[model samples]
Target: MSSFFGAFRRRLLTPPVSETTMEVRGFHVKNAEAKQRLEYIGEVFLKGYAYAVEAGSPAEAEELLETVPRDMRGFAYEGAGMGAAVYDSLPGHGGRLQGLLAGRGRDHDYMIYVGIGWAMARLPKPLWPDIRSTDPLLRWLALDGYGFHQAYFKTAAYVRTPHVQHPFRWRGGHNHYTANAIDQGIGRALWFVGGTDPDVVTDLIRAYPEHRHSDLYAGAGLACAYAGSVGEDELARFVEGAGEHRWALAQGSAFATEARIKAGTVIDHTHLAARVVCGTTAEGAAQVCRDTRPRTPEAAGPFPAYEAWRHDIAAQLASSSLVSKGADQ
Candidate 1:
């Protein structure tokens, strides 16, 4: 009895082990050096995000963002934007986000603008009553959102719009290279506005010409998977409204859904969005990701794995038809 009690006491005192590991499975970086660099940036981003959320200031976030090497600045900026969004509930959040955007010019990696979209998507609706009021910031963000659609899938549209200039100017001169980064931000923001007022999401979809509808709906689908606020009925409505763009929407949703799952950010509704948008299980979408993702051996640059994954995912999604069929089913 003494031994039994002692064993039980030890078991109670023992720390429970967690299954979650720091190593990511579906996603991979290039070489060990690149992996280390990516990991360091990720660490810095978490630190900065935590600091901003805790202290309710963007200064520390900006400081840390600037420290990221220029080559990886796009990814870092998106992370910073996400961090800013996490702290959007804090006072003066708008001013800080606007300041960050002001400091970083429009030409700064388009992904950074997408990051801004991420922050905006997560922001409260009351704070942005004039999204359609021709405010320069709002206009630029809207244009940037459109630009992201064009650049990612290599769709036929002028990159420069009346409100914004060329949004996707990579040093390497490949707009497709930055597609995933661009969509991540846009999709997140789409969900943001969609949750606050599905009308806005609808308006934005209609705001663009019929030719651009696919990209618009695709971004909305991505948001549907990420934004927790959107309900099943709303998703169904959006899918029904997508019309010819339904496939694009499902494709985008699948990409983001797979990414969310791989990143370990899968919420209860993540898979639901995929089911509604793509007519497939989350596991099926992930299988597509695994099957379609480009291996590191076929990639180039410091972050080959990531770039390859995004490139292949974009290509596959561009031609994917799962969403349209899913909605019909």
Candidate 2:
């Protein structure tokens, strides 16, 4: 009965599934495969989200999410993160999100944090402070999630309008780097927005101010690796298109490989992107991510820890002997 009540409440609160469709969103259609794959991600994500909201415990949610095929299981966890965030924001609920991060959900930590950002787009502004994370470095992923939501849902303002949202005074006034984090999310969404067309996606990014290109390219590289809808050739072409920003692209690819590997969700697509973008195997690229990560992120830089960490990864990727090895192949 308690489970039933929780789920009932969620059903009323959840966004309609159609909202994720390209047709509903008026997004580009690159191919039937990309179309179906994108829609399927949305369906699976909502399923995970609903389960997280309805399940009696985070463990129960994990059990149900694990039932999703291994390739997509992390996405379910990502959705569950969004669900947990939204659930915790409700009047009767509190601390479930913190509990989620503390328990079995820890493995999919990156996705979960990104999911919490999705909840930021849905919930009232007053409740924003309650959405918390134990890891300072990863808390920015919430902004990434927020950017994805705005781009995915509010296409006119965020994507087509080419209007980047103003940096909010979020996460206890970490104002300086907030927009950069949001731009990363926007870049990821462009992969979907252009139907994974390297030409179209590159053009879209080119439209943005030159200063924003690096973060956007990195975000695109992460999506190209993680939620792939393109082939090896397309991946290489995106690298070529990125030009001076290729290092940032590799950095983003490494980040995706690291996230997928950490969540135990590495797949063929993950390997493909890592190889093309980072010029290394998934494991190798993930290692690069770990190798360059800021051990003490809070004190790591004049540019802030997260940005500094990303720059270090990009520098390593750009200088590595492996750079362009796979792209040449």
Candidate 3:
């Protein structure tokens, strides 16, 4: 099919798959299981990318994306979103990402937002397609996606040396939540970069300022929810080790739950991660995210609506934890 060659050409526009491995990146591995798990995530994303690029239309791509294993389907959609963005960014091409977003892609909007960030990382700002119509609240996820790309591909600058700088302040120069969103993404990458070992991931987060621990832990918690590399017992241990940031971790887990539920990609592991990391069932944790989510069209704050939503969720979890502690006492 002509689509196959198109997909191949688009893929050629990016780095090869092997470059994503820990060995290729000279990063440490927690264990074989962790490496295998993260690598699978990449493979799924690439499959989605290929499908989107190869398809004649978004509807065709959706059919292909739906064929991915149920457990990893969301990642494929994320990849498809990334692929669309890359195509749209081409000098002669445009509207592919916009078309996907407006079509069946709406079901997986959150991932697409993050996926677009991946394209943003690879392409110049001028070349970036106009996606201003994206929700004001969720748009920050593009930065989160960008952060993950940087940390995943440029480990030296984002992880080990860590000298990332934001392009500008947000909310009319009132806050730098953009950087926070990106750090949250970096935190997610830390999950992969640290080989899914809780100790190594926590240590890497600890190396940052105490203030950033919450966002970092939040990202890590989301990654844990996505195709978890470990089981409930280990995830429970992660909760225990989270210390003061437990609420933030739970909040991130809850966000992941909401995203999966919205995309209709919820799996058994999604429930397990929600229960262990969030101290609630997947539906319950998702409800917490929903309840804390701002209702207004705009969230007014020193923080953006997205970060504000994050703060509220963490607060809700912190409050629930306090109540549970009191009952136990």
Candidate 4:
């Protein structure tokens, strides 16, 4: 059943290439072009990963990384995450990528670390056993992930915190924070770190004293829901750990679940993730997400359906909580 769903998901997310363009959310690109771009990015990631696996030291990997085009470095960073994930299956690659990342300064190259964080979040739990350790690079990536979440979501609580300076800018003059890459990276990093222990979420909240507690919790919540390994018991611990910030985490999880549903990446785990974050049954969350999904052509932005789904869920969660409590009482 898992294999079937996996095949189905791949088919849905990666349709056959064609001359005509396809639109998802709002961006439109030729099918072939999109596939080619992703392939190129994937190739870059493999090259970096291979280099890290065989090279004399982390320095060599960094050198090879520099050769990649600056514009594509973010994607390359993401690829490095993939490489790290792949390298995990082999011996001695445990901290190779992390070592390489440690050499890069976070002030200017934060997004690159964000890319790596995103990949780490998405990879399996065993890939990085020391994720919970106070490794400076891991800590920086996790904190930056939270910071990125605050900047991108623009949650009221985080408005006062200074925004991280992103080196890359979108074509439409939007800041790097506005790009989906940042969001993905941050959310995934949370999951990666959170997978180590829900308590890590609390530790991260404390680690970044300047940022809003709510924003940090939200990132952790998204990570818990999307972490893939978190179960009902672990989810409960995360919810408890979040304390006053549970609602923020719920919103983040709901948003992440909705994004997965919108992309037709629904799997058994998707249902579990929705259940954990919303305190609602998986079916209930899926219905809400499906009902709120934006129709094609009507969905005009990079994330119209995603935006709509989150809005609907947020409003519903807000309004229904009182009613649910009343009924329970």
Candidate 5:
């Protein structure tokens, strides 16, 4: 129990980048019992993500779930099991760590989400209905499955809108559902949500602090600016400074779905394919993508058009920044 409390205590010491980490007060479980406590906490994190989406903003969502019960929660183990299944079926070493640590800690929300996203994306969408709502343990399966679909579709539209001439069509080279499902699964499971959401997770890069991934800061900074969470100048500085890591890795980075469907003959570029398949408006295809894409620590820089969009965001920020500065002055 001491070990568990020690670990939990250490986690509590770490603050979320955008908000104060929730206080784990009155937590008196001993080390021998700490393992169970940690698993239960993991479910809260999943619940938090679900509630966060439902709340439509990260901050408000966090507040709404602060008082939710944390007893008898243990999806981390199930998440690990599902994650391993997905990893085994897919290529590459992505998501393996996340799979192993699915139910370990609050920090592992990303991994759990990733695995869920991967599973949701890969598995047919119809299977995402509430299957285990009454049971705490089974409830996670539904949360994991549906939450991934919701988040992936949100991001997919953002990436596809400009490139896709039609809307969220999903035909032709689009395959938006299939394509997005694959990318989100692969990404969340192996990359972005490895142990934590990129927005909150830090310290586990190939190197050290101060030199952390620019995309992570930039993306979060942009969200901060847009959501009125941070100043425009700061957002601009972060976005601009982060652009130094930009790299153009040829255009068509084919994903697994296309690779498998076409059997390695025709590389289906996710961007172009998504564009072709999406509906007429960015909001169509069930609003498959959000207006913005969060930058991962590993993204090569914003996409070309995304870079241009940042300029627009920065310009808006500039106007707001000037007003703010003038008021201060």
Candidate 6:
């Protein structure tokens, strides 16, 4: 009874933040997803890297990573690359390639490295939060246009294109953000099969750069198809191919076009939350193995939950977005 009264009182005191204001406020707040994902990755550094490396090798690691449930594969990739300086094979979210080109000059190494940073930042976190309409103004503020743009800037850097300067120069970067959104929306299922610390890839997918975004998901599907029974090196090659394939797409692609493609790949809320929890757990475990104790009970808790959360969130977002579009039509 007292708790109910307290809740009612708090609701009565809350004020609204206009959508326009939320757009403004969004630009100012540092992206929570970006910060959280990076910290978690930092925690799981060795194990994550080892897993990533194995996934890339023609050995056991690839099989382990590949065997993760289809819905969870994308999320698992995020956990592995959280601490990595370069991150590739993230196609489902958008903004990565575009963000890379815009943030880093056209220099291949610089741009790819920037993309790697973005991949590390975006994969585990959702671009959008699950804010109920009934929530307070502050929460809604996080969903406004300006807020969205600011969040975009978290894992990305802006460039002085002909029509734009920063995130706010247009509607969430305008055509730049939109073009890539399709690729981002679809690439969620793929994995980065190879590359160094941050950047990774797969060669089979690389053969057709023009189809990089659309076809990348095929790699994930392929990985899922043969994950358990495959050898370590074969699995690694497939995973590595995912990254290598993306790198191929990045090169020779126009600056603006690539940015659009990359930008489209940002993850949504469920994956973001799951990765944070998983990453923190992985990092803690690694710390213990390296330092205090060898086997801690708390170490393994984050993995399954991370997988489940990612699967559920991805499914929900996909379905909701589809339904919303149909309703609008």
Reference-based lDDT, each prediction: 0.48, 0.83, 0.79, 0.47, 0.29, 0.27
Better of 5 and 6 by lDDT: 5
- Compute the lDDT of residue 228 as modeled in candidate 5: 20
Q: Per-residue alpha-carbon lDDT of model 2 for 35-99, expressed as tens digits?
A: 99988999988988988888777777777888999899878888988998888877877766777
The parts of candidate 4 lying over 4 Å away from their true place are: 1-168, 172-184, 209-216, 259-269, 291-312
Worst ten-residue run, lDDT, model 6? 189-198
Q: Order of candidates by lDDT, top first?
A: 2, 3, 1, 4, 5, 6
Query: lDDT at 193 for candidate 1?
Result: 30
| Model 3 lDDT, full chain set | 0.79
Give the CA lDDT, 0 to 100, for residue 109 in model 6. Answer: 22
TM-score-best of 3 and 4: 3
Superposed Cα deviation of residue 275, candidate 2 (Å): 1.1
Q: Candidate 3, residues 53-117: lDDT per residue as tens digits?
A: 76777777787888888778888888887888888776676677777778767878888888888
- Candidate 4, backbone clash total: 1
Per-residue lDDT of model 1, residues 1-329, tens digit only: 12453244324322122211114311222235533543453454343333334333355446655666553454455555444443444454444445445555222323344444434444454543233322322233333343433332222232212122234433222345344345433433443333324555666556545655655566667656644355678778878877776767776677666655654446667788877777677877666767875543333554435445544554555445445557679
Worst 10 residues of 3 by lDDT: 165-174
| Candidate 1 clashes between residue pairs 3 or more apart in a chain or in different chains | none
Q: What is the C-alpha RMSD of each candidate to the true structure, in Å?
A: 18.2, 2.3, 2.4, 18.5, 18.9, 23.0
Clash counts per candidate, in order, are 0, 0, 0, 1, 23, 63
Top candidate on lDDT is 2
The sequence of per-residue lDDT tens digits that candidate 6 reaches over residues 274-321 is: 122111122221222223211221224423221222233333333443
TM-score sort, best first:
2, 3, 1, 4, 5, 6
Give Cα distance to truth, residue 17, candidate 5, Å: 24
What are the models' TM-scores?
A: 0.46, 0.94, 0.91, 0.43, 0.24, 0.20
Residue-level lDDT for 76 in candidate 2:
87
In terms of lDDT, which candidate is stronger, 3 or 4?
A: 3
